[model samples]
Structures are given as C-alpha cells and as structure tokens.
Target chain A: MCFRDAAVRLRAQTIWSGVSLEVAPGEFVAVVGPNGAGKSTLIKAILGVHALSHGEASVLGLPPGQAGRRIGYLPQRRSFDASLRVRGVDIVRLGLDGNRWGTPLPVADRFRGSRRRDRERVAEVLELVGATSYATRPIGQTSGGEQQRLLIAQALVHDPELLLLDEPLDSLDLPNQAAIAAVISGICRDRGITVLIVAHDVNPILSYLDRVVYLARGRALSGPPSEVITSETLSQLYGTPIEVLHTSDGGLVVVGHPEAPAHHSDRHTGRTHERP
Target chain B: MIPSAGATGLSWNVADDVRQLFAQHFMVNALAAGTIVAILAGSVGWFMVLRRQSFAGHTLAVISFPGAAGATLLGVSATAGYFAASIAGALVIAAVPGTGRGRGYTNQSAVIGTAQAFALACGVLFVSLYGGFLDSLNGYLFGTFLGVSDRQVLTLLAVAVVVLATLALVGRMLLFATVDTDVAATRGVPTRLLSIVFLVLLGCAAAEVSQITGALLVFALLVMPAATAQQLTARPAVSLGLSVVLALVIVWLGLGVAYFSVYPVGFYVTTFGFAGYVLAASGRALITWAGTRRRATPAVTR
Candidate 1:
C-alpha cells in the first residue's frame, strides 16, 4: 500500500496534508496519534470512502476501492445493544458473502460446493480468532473483548490481502489489547497480509508493530518504531514540547505541555477536551 | 350476499366458527389481502427494526394518511394515493442530507417528524376540502378489511411479489450494511444506495399495510411481529420466518374475532400483536432472570 502526498479535507478544514507513506507486503504497521489527527480519515481515504483532496493512494497494486474484494476492513468500535439478537457466527459469515446480491438458497444448487466452501471459511476464521466457543451466542451478550475477536474473525473470513482496522483496541483492557495485538501480528506474519491499524495508544501494540506512522499537527512521519517514537520526533510532530518516557517494561508514555496534556493515554475515559 | 356474523353470532364449536368465517367471500378476500400484507410487512419490518428505523417506518405509514386523503379528494383510488404519497415521502426522507449517524441522525429525525406532522395536517385539510362524510375518512384512517375487492387482493398480491423479490435480491447486502455500515462500505457495498432502496421498499410496505390495518395502526403488522420474533431467537433466518408466522397468526385471529364482534379488524389486530410482543418480551426477561439465578446458585455452592 502506498500514498503519495495524500491530503484530506472535510468541510473546508484540512485534516492532514502532504502525507506520503508506503508499506511492504506482510508488514504490520500502526497509525498512532492524538485524537483528531485524522488517523481514521487516513484509513477511510485508503478505502476510497473519503476522497483525498490532493495526491493519490493505491492499495494492493490498484487504486483504493478497486481492490476492495481483496481488502478486509474493521471500522471503529461500535457498541451493540444487548437486545441485538445477531449471532457472532452470522456476523463472521457475512464477511464471506454479505456483498452478494441475493440471499442464499436452501435448496441444493450446482454451486453447492461453493456454499460448503463458504461455510468452512467462516468456521475457519472463527476458530482462528478463538471465538469458536461463543460463535453461536448472540454477539451483544458477549464481552467487549469477545466481540472484538468476532469482528476480527469477520474481517479475516474472506482471506483478504490487505487489512485495515480502525481503533480495534479502543475500549479493551490491557491484557486483551495485548492479546489482540499479538493475534493480528501473527496473522500478518503467517498469512503475509499487510495491515494498517489506527490506535490511540501505541504501548499495547508497540512490541508487535514493524512500522509506525505518527500523525499530528496536520502532518505525518513514517519510519521504524524506534526511529519515530522518540521525544524529539513526537515533540516536533505535535509542534509542542512533548516528552516520551520509556518505562522499565519498554512501554512508552507521552506527556505534553502541562496545561495542554498530551492526548495519548492508556485510559481514554473522562478526558473530553480532545479536538475532533 | 354473504352472511354477516350478526345473524349467527359465534358458536361454541371451534371448527364451525372457522368454517363460518371462511364461508363469506368478503372474509376470504380480507384474509387473502391480509396474508400478502403480513408476509411482506414481516420480512421488511424485520430489517426496519434491526436498523432501528421504526421512526422512519412510522413516518412512511403516517404519510399514507395524507396520500389516501389526497387521492380521495382528487377522485382517484385511495390505494393510488397511499402508494404515491408514501413513496414520495420516502424519497424526501432519503434525500435529506445526513449519514444517519450522530448529528446527521438528529437532523434526519427532525425532518422526519416534521414530515409526519405536515402529512397529518394535510390529511385533515383534504378531508375538509372534499366535504366528505366522516365515515369514509374513518375507513382510510382506521382501515376496513370488510369490503376488500378481488382486484384489490390481486393488486396487493402483485405488489407483495415485487417487493419481496426485490428484498430477496438485496437481503444479504442490506443486512451487512445495516449491521456494520462503515465496514460494508469499505467492502464496496453501496451502503447509502442500499439504505435508499430499503426505505423505498419500506414505503411500499407501509402503503400496503395501511390498506389493511389503517394508517394509524400500521405498526400492528410492521413492528410487533418482527419485534416479538427477534426477542424469541437470535438467528436471522429463523427470526424472520417466525416473524411471518406470528404476523399470519395475528391477522387470522384478529380477522376472525372482528367478524364475530362489532369492533373493527384493526383493533383486534393491534390487540393481538401487542399481546404477542408482551409475551415475548416477558419470556425473554424471565429466561434471563432464571439464568442469572442459576449461575448464582453454583457460585454459592462452590
């Protein structure tokens, strides 16, 4: 996947501009930044849902959306009402044939083999994500981590070449976040599928990511995690004095100007001052 | 002329009353039209409730009031007005500039509410302009299954075939878009276009249901059965089929009961539907309570 001087504007406000980045096959990359850095917008632009105001982007050797059939996407987290009665397995199966024009027929057809193949694929992905135990349960009744796993299984059911996930770990606990990150990293390595994940905090996925694209102040800097996660780089990116502190366990904490606290925090609750 | 239940009243024999009910030609026509309306509304309403667009569905049903009234005023068939006004209202709602999320959703609801209110007012205006007796207006507003003609039954059947066929063609993609729109959009599903198509189909459903349950009580067919079925099961196909079955039961029983009484069919339909929904909801709650208690018992024993 590649972007050449890509820029996006919404309602006359330039979200981010002149952002050039590229990812190699099988690479696991994280797009991390403060809130309102347009990480989600970047994902949308790559998916061709949000048209770039300038420059261009290509995914899987084709223009964005043209290669949609081979690109799997998990949008930002959405809370399912407890009354929602859709089973987790059905959600996974939808990834396999949800885009098809017609409902599946119960009667045997010439394509019976393909129907069997589709069911097998859904089961395979569900097992892969460790959601087989609760696949038959209503998705809304599951815990947050369980739902996230089901969603990941849904994204992987079709075996796409490229996967774009927006905030897959937003509300998960630290352990679940680390586990999900490891699962995604394993998929990236074993299946050789390129991944672009948008995240609020970088610590959970820091160990597994091959590259990091840090966006802030209407700009982006992409490089190896080690090169771009330093205090100097982030401070420069935020256009403010920011400090990146490495913990004893190798996790990093970013703290900004005392009055304008940095937006990157592990616990993203009750802090509502971030810009959109 | 077919005999009215007023002559024989309802007998103690179950089979005999049913036989008497089906013996009337008008009753047969009502049942035929009701069956088609039930199936179409059941299937479509499943998605409508799933999408949480009951408000939009209600608005379309409300639009039918003005549509029927306007048609009556213009010396056209009230059915034509029901279709025309509801479809046009659907287009207007779909054209409203909003992504159906957050702020856009707020804007959409406001517009929909405005449209519904305006529609009701227009219905009253049309009725007054025509200087028609309140009896005809009551029929359109409260529905009349008594005088259903063969052509109306055929028309309802034709519309059901087309609507259900279109729904089948787009069912999978529509569910995908409704459940997880952003991902579906990235997957190249035309989420916006599908939403519009579903709304139009919903409009058609509202219009047809208005012909049976009346504009004010369309929810009797459009929401209750689907809601009850959903509460009973988590599987889409099973729940959808159950919705249809529940609708059929409600319509058949409601028509039967109404035939024996002085009340309109809409009253019995709404009553039976509400009863079913209450049963389903309470049953779900009871099961959840029992499960929690059972789980608690194990913890205490340990």
Candidate 2:
C-alpha cells in the first residue's frame, strides 16, 4: 500500500505535509510523535475517514473504503455508553460481522451458524490476549486496562491482515502498557499481520518495530530506528537540540531543555554538537 | 380500565382491545397512525439517545409549532406544514458537520434555533393575516389526543413499522457507527449512510408524533422511554422493549390523567417522563452503591 505525498491541513493547524510512505505485508511499523503531531492523522487518513487535501493514499492495494474487511482498528480508551451492556463476546463479534440489533437479515442468510463461529473466534482472541476469563463480562463493567485488552481482542477478532492502533496504551498504567505492547507484538508476528501503531514514545516498541516514523510540526522522519531516530533528526523535528543519550541506566533518552538556550552538553554526541 | 378475571390472581384479559381497538373506524385509524409513529419514534429515539440528540428532538418540536400555527391560521390541516418543516429542519442540520461546530447543542442546537425562530416569525405573520380568534391553532400546537383523526393515526402506524424494520436489518452497522465510528468506517460499515438513515427516521417520527402530542410534546413520549431504558438495562433488545413499554405507559397514563384534569396529555406525559428518568437513574445509583459496599465489606472480613 502507498501513502503518496500526503498532506493534511486543519483550519488553523497543519498536521502532515508532503509525506510519502509504503507499507508491505506482515510489517510492524511504529509511529511516534508528541501531542499535536500528525501521528493519529496519518492513521485516519489511511482509513479514509479523513481525506488527504493533496496527494493520494491506498490501503492493501485498494482505496481505504474498499479495503474494509482487511483492516482492523483499535482506538484509544474511551468509555462506551454505559447502557450498552455489550459483553466482550458481542464487541469481538462485531469484528467478525456487525451486530444486527432490531433488523433481522432475510432468510437463507441469517448467519445462524455465524453466531457460533463468532463466539469461538471471540474466545480465541480473548485467549490470545489473556482475556478469556472475562470474555463474558460487559465492557462497561471492566476497568480501563481490562477494556483496552478487550478492544485489542475486538480489533483482531476478524483476523484482519492489517491492524491500525491509535495510541492504544495512552490511558493504561505502566504494567498494562507493557502487557498490551507485548501481546500486540506477539500476535502480529505470529499471525504475519501488518501493523501501524501510534504512541507518544517509540522506545517501548523499538525492538519489535521494523520501521519508525517521527512526525512533528507538519514534517516527518521515517526509516529504520537506526536511520531515523538519531539525535540530529530529532533535534530538527523538535526545533531544539535534542540529546539521544545512552544513559548510565542502559536506556535511551531524547531530551531537550527549552529554557536552557545556548547550552549544549550531551554525554553521547552525534552528527553535530550545538555550541554553548 | 382492564380487569383481572381469575381466582389464580395471575391472569387477566388483555382488554380484548387489541382487536376492538382497531375495529371502530376512528380507533382503527388512530391506532394505525399511532403504530407508525411509535415505531419511528422507537428507533429514532434509540439513536437519538446514542447521539445525545435529545436537544435536536426538542428543537424540532419547538420549531414545527410555527409551521402549524401558520397553516392553522388559514384553517388547514397543520400536518402538511409540519411534515414539510420537520423534514427541512432535519436536512439542514444533517448538512452541517457533526463536531466542533458552534455554541449551544453544536450543529443540532444551531439548526433548531435558527429554524424555530424563522417559524415563529412566520407564524405570527400568518396569524395576523387571518385574525379569526386563533384558538384552533393553539390547540394543534399543544396537541389534542382526542383530536387524532382516523387518517392521521393510520399514517403514523405505517411509518413506524417501516422505520423499526429498517433499524432491525441495519442494526449491526448502526451500532458500529454509533459506538466506534472510526472503527466502523475502517470495516466499511457505510457510516454516512447510517447517519442519513437515522436523520430521516427521526424526521418521520417527529412529524407523526407532532400530530397527537403536537411537535413540542413528542419528546415526552419519544425521549423518556429510551432514556429510562438506558439506566435500567444494557442489553439493546431489552432497552428498546423497555423504552416502548414505558412510552406507552406514560402516554396512556397522561391521557387518563388529562381526562381528570384541565391540562393536556402532553404536559402530564412530559412530567411523568421526567419523573421516570429520575427514578431509573436513582435505581441505577443504588445498585452501584450496594455493589461497592458489598465489595468493601469483604476487606473488613479479611
């Protein structure tokens, strides 16, 4: 699939500009950016919910709208209507096929057996995400972390070939975040599903990502982590000297102090060290 | 009043009115029309609660008053003017984007306010033109349940059945669209189509209910039942069933009460609906509180 020369503009803000990218089958890409960056916009544009003002985009060799069955999505945590006592099974079943509510389909295609299959698939996905114990529970009754796992299960229930996640762990605590990220990585890898996940930091997903794209201020840097996450690229993206340090704790940090103007000291220097 | 007839103290004749209710020409027509309006209101009210468009419901009712007022000033059936104005109001609001639009009810409020104001102005002008002791117009505005004609009732029933059936078939997609629109679109659910369908259904319901309850009074019967259902149950089917049941209870009760009082059924129904919502909400809270207390008690045991 191709996202060719894509640009997005809000009334008073520009999110993405002149960005081009390609996604292949079974690839897991991480999109990392700060707030107000174009990460989520990229996901939505690819889904065709938000049209690109300029250039063209396609999904799975088809336009986004036409690629419906192939793309599964997980949105960030938002409380659903409390009255919808939708069991985890029901939500996951939606991925397999939507809920029929008041409308019964015509005869010869009522999908009678589909109910059983949907339940089985729901169980399988719940098991995959360690949520089998609560698959029968109502979504509204679950905690935030629990709801997030269910959401992931819902996204994968149909066994879609491509998965798009919009900051899936933004609301979860640290332990849940690690748990969800691990589940995502294992499932995508085992199933050979292509994934594009957005998060504020790429470090949690750094090991599993085949490529990382950093979007900031309407511009972007994309490539393998080694190529695009360098200090020089990040500094330019943030409009400040950002230090990518191999800290004593064996972790990488991208830091820039806005108040400390003209002061540049990095334990690990790269490309060009700005003068103090 | 329907009476229980067995020593078992459990069974009762169901008024035998389901048949007789439709036997008399006026009853038959009023019921036919009522069924159509009920189904339309039921489905539209379902999504109206989902979209938090109760305000839209109220606004449409208010604005349609002017349409009725003007039509009646010339001694015409106000239904024609109401149907036209209601449809127009729904379409205009539907045309506006759903989010981040403006102050007061977003696009829903903005459309209602503008449409209603224009309607009120038109109504005054029409009244001025005719000037024939404009009490009939006022009565239509408030809705007279006794005024329900045979023809109007039949039309209401017809429309309701269609709306309810349509919702039944596309329900899965509609749910997907309402709960997680982004996900729904990605899965190719035709979210836009669902939206348009919802708007049209709502338009039809508003139009029919505008006849018996009057435009301004439809919400009492439309919104109350669904809202009450929301706090009472989480199951979609159950919620819908409860909504319809509650609306019927309130409307009929309001009608009965109106028979004993000077006020119209609309006033009584709205009051009853508001009280019903409060009661259901309180019940929900009580259950939640009890559950929490029960959980905390185990900590003390430990």
Chain A TM-score vs. truth, each candidate: 0.92, 0.84
Over 4 Å off, model 2: A1-24, A35-37, A48-58, A62-66, A75-91, A99-111, A131-142, A216-228, A232-241, A247-250, A257-276, B1-36, B99-111, B117-138, B252-264, B267-275
List model 2 lDDT by residue over A87-204, tens digit each. Answer: 6666776767773444423232335676565667778898999988876666667776777788888889888888989877665667777888899999889999998998865666
Error of 2 at B100 (Å): 11
Worst 10 residues of 1 chain B by lDDT: B98-107
The DockQ scores of all candidates, in the order shown, are 0.70, 0.39
Docking class of 2: acceptable
lDDT per residue for candidate 1 within A91-179, as digits (tens), equals 98888889998864444323588888888888888878889999999987888888889999999988999898988888788889899
Error of 2 at A241 (Å): 4.8
Backbone clashes in each candidate structure, one number apiece? Answer: 0, 14
Strongest candidate by DockQ? 1
In model 1, chain B matches the true chain B with a TM-score of: 0.95
Q: Tens digits of per-residue lDDT for model 2 on B197-252?
A: 77666776777777777766788777877888877866555666777778777766
Compared to the true structure, candidate 1 yields what TM-score?
Answer: 0.92
